[model samples]
Target: MKKFLSLILALTMLLSLVAVSANAEDITLDVIIAQYGPNTQEWFLGKGMDGSNFVEKFEAANPGIKLNLEVVSWNDLYTVVSTRISNNNAPDILNIDVFADYANEGLLMPVQDYCPEELYQDFFPSFIDQSVIDGTVWAVPDLASARALFYNVDLLQEAGVEKVPETWAELEDASQAILDAFGGEVYPWGIDMTTDEGQAAFAYYTWGNNGGFVDENGEWVLNSDANVEAIEYAIGLVNKGFTNPNPATQTRYDLQDMFAAGKLAMIIAPNQLPTYVTDKEGNVNLATAGLPHNEGATSSSVGVMDRIMAFKDDAAPDQAARNEAIGKFLTFFYDPENYVGWVSMEGFLPAVNSAVGALVEADPSFQAWLDVLGGAKFYPTTKAEWNDVKQGVIDVEQQALTGGNVKELLDALQAKIAGK
Candidate 1:
């Protein structure tokens, strides 16, 4: 830890003498970190996870660079960011899920402009691929999670489900068996079509059926035959009394609670399901399996990742110097010494390979999640039309839940996205 002491000494001198060097100009980065949960605010600014202050350490490491960091809840982040962007006062660094809008709008700096090459190389290649538009990478993943089928083991055993369903037909049969055993006391399956996670509902079935938001060429293909069939099958499950009664209103949180309480026999959820259940004091024998696929289709693990991106600042006098400072910030943030806690604290999988061994050491369960994440298929966030497609699929599902034609709704969405 000699390096740590050196940083401390540098910071002490910088504070007392007010300058590390005559040329060391002070730089303050305005950063907005999304509040993922209760402790995120404390992790970056206060005495939170590990009781080590991130800002203090970062500043000490690089004397002249100060962090004016703000933690914004997900609810207010979009509004706060939008207001700032419109006012041409965007933060130097931002953490959020969707970045295509900012990137396409020319509001974000290319990752190459600020990301350290060694640090950039440490990021998972697949994860980095998701943030690229054309040939340029725009952001880096903060954390990632894989979605899979979580089943109540005791409930399934009692229901006579001999094996975890691997295909849609088997899933339907298992669902029916659970229905027969529970007699309406427990939902055989949980489907979330609420606005909060409706897009995810689209992914569960469509991606499972080998029908996804885009084609192999990354073009919008929402109304393809495969997608129509997938959506129809999902709606069929709800109609057949095999799923939760109110798919349109029941959110992921609601479904998670039901699953934890043994009220839902099966649900598609992330790796953090166990952590969530434990925290909520819900008891159940839970096991996970890949999402069931349709016949002749693929069973794909759905991966979810939120990103950290830097914004363009045309007003900066020294772009290279500013980018270097940003690089140092990233380097510090993802250092295994700091990143392992950030990922583990949030109960998420790491986006960088450097944090893997440490995370798995801390929790063996992380290894299994890492395995699932390896083969996972991500959303097409690289596409400029991603937000529209995300919301469009949700709308299509909500309408179909209300008896609208799934095929017709998807066809309409396809045309809308195509500007037809």
Candidate 2:
């Protein structure tokens, strides 16, 4: 009777082991993506991926891996991510603009842990560098958009402006000409100093004046001489009635809408402005020019990029298998055929070199834009103090707009951030 009972227990243990093995073969990844536009959700979960969604196709190709992808809007992304992290429920994969905080906190897995070497090599070197912190790559750039000066060709001609502005003096001259021609019926230039986009305003003007958030060595310089001059000049535009009224309240969308309706003559915008105008059914004849700079300052195209990062998940039963699954997901996502379509659908620039040829082939203008992006200067988002500087500059700009001294405000901000 004792032998019979032992045999029965052994058989039951064998059955349990078999069940565990079967379950180990399947894994699920929770991915959170920031919505780029109206098409972002459709492309990922709907029928935007050549009649098949990304989740469906990826699962079909990799049978063992399943995806739970969620699209979060920009407004709530930071809050959502923060809440999840506080609850220790961080997503397996995250797509967002900032990563230094996560990486610095040791919550992210290094890129090499899951990214295939071949796929890693395909990313643009400059773009890849942007995600590095202290010799470690924390994330991979997903996509980028370069900013430039967009003007209404007919409006400039009608204003008797002979050529596109390449310097601040020229820009001011053109603004005056447009104002005189239209008698203030149209805003000569658009500035977005609203809280939602004041960082961009800071970049557009400060970088143009040979001042930026950091030095060549990536140290903070928020109160540099050039920066003070830049802020003063921007405020001067408002005081002189050369820019859109209520810049403190007007946002990029408001400016874009004004541009679409011919209420704005010139604005610094992303590459998607023309598509934006077309979508709005506007018939304005637009032309692009390099962002104007101070006479001796170098002109730089401002590039905005978001990244894909994997969070640390130490609780997996088989770490190697999980890493391999993540790698497959990235490979499938970055495959030139799929990447080209995704980039084109959103009208943004590709982050990988492999998609460049196909994109340029589809649109000749893509080549020119790609060339511009190659030399573009990006924000210092990799810094641990990036958020402080971003909000600090915006405050400085807003304060300057309302009778606050630019130098004093910037000095205080610099002191505050430096102390941090």
State every prediction's TM-score relative to the real structure: 0.92, 0.94
* Model 2 C-alpha lDDT per residue in residues 1-420, reported as the tens digit of each score: 999999999999999999988867799999999999999999999998888899999999999899999999999999999999999999999999999999999999999999999999999999999999999999999999999999999999999999899999998999999999998788999999998989998998899999999999889999999999999999999999999989989999999999999989999999999999999999999999999999999999999999999999888888888889889989999999788999998999999989999999999999999999998999999999998989888888899888999999999999999987
Candidate 1 per-residue lDDT, tens place, 86-135, comes to 89899999999999999989998999989989999999999999999879
User: What lDDT score is found at residue 176 in candidate 1?
Assistant: 94
lDDT of each: 0.91, 0.93
Instruction: Please tell me which predicted candidate would have the highest TM-score against the true structure.
Output: 2
Worst 10 residues of 2 by lDDT: 19-28
For model 1, which pairs clash? none
User: RMSD to the native, candidate 2?
Assistant: 5.0
Q: After superposition on all CA atoms, what RMSD does each candidate show versus the true structure? A: 7.1, 5.0
Q: In terms of TM-score, how similar is model 2 to the real structure? A: 0.94
Q: Candidate 2 regions off by >4 Å?
A: 1-24
